[model samples]
Target: MTNTAPSLVLPEISSARLTGLLEFLQSAEQLKDTLRSGTTANGRPESTAEHSWRLALMVVLFEPELKDIDLLKLLKLALVHDLGEAISGDVPAPLQTPGDNRQERERRDFLTLCEPLPADIAEELLSLWDEYAAAVTAEARIAKAFDKLETMLQHVLMPRQEASFYAFNLGYGVDRTDCSPLTRQIRDKVDGLTRALMEDAGRESA
Candidate 1:
């Protein structure tokens, strides 16, 4: 557990209510230590918190281009899209098998993680998560695309991983990214990089 607590600026509220909010936020801090399958440039495992941070950053950076969408809602979707992973950890797309019930498991975990928050706040977060999970709304769809792109971006930009790692990304998450022109453009570039990495990894092995 991270010993350092964040300096939160909360509005004036009842001590009990404030304590509940603080406890929920504190539990959420565990995401900083929850490792994902990807690694940093230095080869350290990336945490779920880092992934969501970048995902939200992606939304902010692309805000001008995404004027048609609800930027705030989209950002929220991105931030919470993988909040479930903070509880159950992440399952890399390539390793996920059919019938794994990963979504179901993650949904349950998300509910548990949100238990400390007020009922309305928790329900709203869950609804956003579910929207992202289902990719039913336009904002949700874009969030999913950004999420996939961010994962692939990290993989390609990181130091040369195994040949299979590069190979796995070639066909990974196409369906999600293909939904938007901006995302598709980004995906194409990432795919090109992935292919280059694949070729390089193959040559080094040969």
Candidate 2:
């Protein structure tokens, strides 16, 4: 006698859900057009997408220094940290003032971006953004450190005028007194890189 087995059926994804996800993905592509302060090796303005990509890589490269942190969560945080720029455009550091509401604006923009996604995914993305912005968790703090380090590294590597160089130094000089050991290490590296760049500039001027 032959035995018949029941076939398992999976629920079909809703067309509305798929459409919303697709729309969100298309919206994220606009991040490539969000210009940041940093320039490429060829002197082109860098995009927020490029910054986010390198930041995630920086997190992995500095993993040995990070202690008791979730690498996966840190990576996710790095990627979404600037997703708000997709909607709000990149706000360069030097342009911000003491009373600027840029952070609040970015948070609102990020929420708007997530509004098209499924409820659970939207919640997760919003939470990740908030956590990074708050810097309350170890992962969030590490992500923040990597973000700053990446920006400083770009300034060190890129060619800049005296005014731009001074602006970069003033904006990005990380104070390590209150930072975690891993963050402090990254900050020291940035300081050394900046010093070397300044010496090179001095030589070229001479």
Candidate 3:
């Protein structure tokens, strides 16, 4: 009788590969210390890790309004969107200068960080990061919208005195045309909130 037993397929992961992955993870931990321009509810500056975590949650919270999207892909995009910032550090949009090589620098840093992983894993990560950076794909566009939305929300939530920088930030280019319906709605809401805050600040100063 011919043997009908299925052959066992062991995973190809090696100890050295795992060690490399671990090193990459350890390096990623630095993101927690990378401060962003936005502040927390308590007025402390926020970190890239905090921003990414909140952005991931925002994906789930806004999923209902973003129909037909691949939620898992969006989630992954949110998590890895700023992983490059782990090495490049957080640079506020308003502070970025024209002809700046920040994107190229971040891309190189991202590649270096991914180098420690297996080829397949590294390729997947690089692909995701590139997609998010390109912002051409539907998922990428939505992710970019959420990133701006989160920043706007943070600005609105922060104390008025501490958030004066937002006046300039609000005027910064935020194109809603490419965003999902839900993202557009949120953008409108953020606009309204920003206007109200500005008005309040004006009244208080007067």
Clashes of each: 0, 0, 0
Can you list the residue pairs that collide in candidate 1? Answer: none
Candidate 3 accuracy as lDDT: 0.84
Query: Tens digits of per-residue lDDT for model 1 on 1-206?
Result: 77698788967887866787898888888899999888998888999999999999999999889968999999899888877877898887767999999999999999998888887788899999989888889999999999889999999768887798888888889999999789999999999989998999999999
* Model 2 misplaced stretches (Cα beyond 4 Å): 1-12, 163-167, 170-173, 176-178
Question: Over the stretch 9-95, how does candidate 3's per-residue lDDT look in tens digits?
Answer: 988878988888898899889899999987888889999999999889999997887787889999999999888889989888868
TM-score order of candidates, top first: 1, 3, 2
Clashing pairs in 3: none
User: Which of the numbered candidates is closest to the native, going by highest TM-score?
Assistant: 1
- What TM-score do all the candidates reach, one by one? 0.91, 0.86, 0.88
**C-alpha positional error of residue 42 in candidate 3 after TM-score superposition, expressed in Å:** 0.8
Where does candidate 3 have its weakest 10-residue lDDT segment? 172-181
Clashes of 1: 0
Query: lDDT (CA) for every model shown?
Result: 0.89, 0.81, 0.84
Q: What lDDT score goes with residue 187 in model 1?
A: 93
